[model samples]
Target: PGHQGTSLKVTDSPRKRGYYVNSPTYGGFDIMTATVGGVWDSFLGEGRRFWITATSDSHRNVEDGGEDLWPGQYAKTYVWAAPDQADIMDGLRHGRIFVTTGDLISELDMDIAGANVGDTAQVKAGQVVTLKVRLRDPAGPNANSDQPELKRVDVIMGDITGKADVKADSNPTTRVIKRFTAADWTRDGEVITFTYSFKAERDGYIRLRGTSTDELEPQADALGENPWPDLWFYSNPIFIRAR
Candidate 1:
């Protein structure tokens, strides 16, 4: 992906979607780190219902002189669906998904105003809504055979400012509005839960990003960076509709 990778010359059709932030692209190239978050911010700035998923990008591996992982051995996209063709397809199309790397988490559920990820919550103009997140962080070792811990979780929120400039590559309105830690949450067995409230004064969206490292933002993937110690999990956005 090119720097920011946003431009107005692209397709405007509803069916059109830009490139995705796959694991290989982000983990293999130091230059692509900025592009990863740029795409996320740019889409939400447009108020479009865009989504992202993790991929193993299976082609080769570090052992094979290529940066890839066995499919689902490292990065995985989890969809909320029944074990059926129709429901599975439907869940994907509607963005009922979360992604994790290195098995940092086995379960994640986030909701606001009873609307889960990829769903829209209708509210009064300035309704205060509570966001609740429950996640299961198993103590079992990951693919690397080392158990990585979840040290922090970030709450990223962005505005729905309507259509965007085709060339816009950044959403200045989006940011890690909150960073939660053990002191901020409660743990029950292997499950940890976090809750926070915000004012929904306008159309916007909120999603999540968590990591085992202390980097406030994901550092650019460095050469030979141990992937296991630096794990991440991401959830699709939950839209807010203020009436």
Candidate 2:
């Protein structure tokens, strides 16, 4: 009920509005939808690399006359940390996490210089930074009984202008900086690795998102269409401080 669009309003002043679209929740379960990344990039531009996680808040099962998927059955948040509870908490607090829908990907790793997600890298402005990304799709079928294929990956960047410059809506300055095709990457047994190099012009953040669907652009969902066929995965951002 709270997730309904009519009951929601996008706002930067969360203290006043008491609510904001945490991430775009449109077209049902289209996890690769650009709307979510757009919203996240906006916050990044405001110097807040807001953390995001995926969960199935399944209060009741559809078989029991409810409309929700079981927890970890549809979406899951993976945190890279030790087995200890405290470490897991620390990982989440630091934004070292990734989310997958329909189990599209089993592993996703990214690094810049020597910093990984949730870590900040300091470098001189105009210096080129190399980003390395490794991803692995599940070799077997997911819950939906379909083996997903990695189609493409996108790198999104947002310039951090500080909280004082934050806007109340979408940040026009943030955008997808690069897109990579799976065919160009090194692959072996469902795993693929790729690298990107870019010159730092200013302080910013970068994140990754990939999809199994071949649609280059997000498609509008028809009424009552199923969203389980499309799978997507998103990674937390890595901050960059260039002086």
Candidate 3:
């Protein structure tokens, strides 16, 4: 799971896998909080960059006996490549992408001292850098027949200490460094902007995650229960190197 620059496939439901995210017998972790978080943290612990993508895993519709949403109906992965297929594949391979669920967010512009996602920038050790983010929720009704409003954005940081300092199963040094609330900012239309600065005590990576629901905490799902209407998005990590 902690593979090198590999893209991790995450989804809220994996029906045929015998363990959905809310399954009572073997499920408790939301893919965003548990699966993707754990993978990104572990990669950072190994001083490597990792990427993530979401899928609907739709084989057929409910009328046809499938329990998954149609592809691109509720979740999407946007890749920042050129029109060429090769370039698109290259972009996906290089982690220039973001994932969204229920069309909660339509656009995200993130930069770390001007370095965009999938880019690494050089800076002095212990340097303080500003992370700027601009995001916009979809302007109109989404798949759920309601416009999703972003409620919170979380900034997660993880120290890249190399493989020598990493554990096989978990990365203890990774955590959410900051959380921006919608109530703390004045919105313009559907867009919101956030800026924060942090000292790069050592080499590390930062990423963003946001949700549309007001539930600050992840609620446990009852056995066989699935909440498909909740909306969320996750951006790829931006790496930093100290000179």
Alpha-carbon local distance difference test for all models:
0.72, 0.70, 0.66
Better of 2 and 3 by TM-score: 2
lDDT of 3 by residue, 1-243 (tens): 011001112435433221343332112224334443465577656766567777655655454555555677667888887899999998888888888876778888889877887777577888988998888876898765777677788888877767744446456777787889976655788888879898877887888878766655445434333334455687888888876
* lDDT tens digits by residue: candidate 1, 1-243: 211111112334211011234432343222222233476677876977677777555555545544455777777788989999999888888889988888888898999988999899888888888999999999998877888888998898888877877877777778788999999989998999989998989988888888888877766554334556767788888998999
Model 3: CA > 4 A from native: 1-37, 164-167, 217-220, 224-226
How do all models score by TM-score? 0.83, 0.83, 0.81
RMSD of each candidate relative to the true structure:
8.7, 7.2, 6.2
Better lDDT candidate (2, 3): 2
Q: Residue 135 CA error for candidate 3 (Å)?
A: 1.1
Give lDDT for model 1.
0.72
Model 2 CA lDDT for position 80: 92
The Cα error of candidate 2 at residue 242, in Å, is 0.6
Residue 130 displacement (Å), model 3: 0.3
- Candidate 2 structure lDDT: 0.70
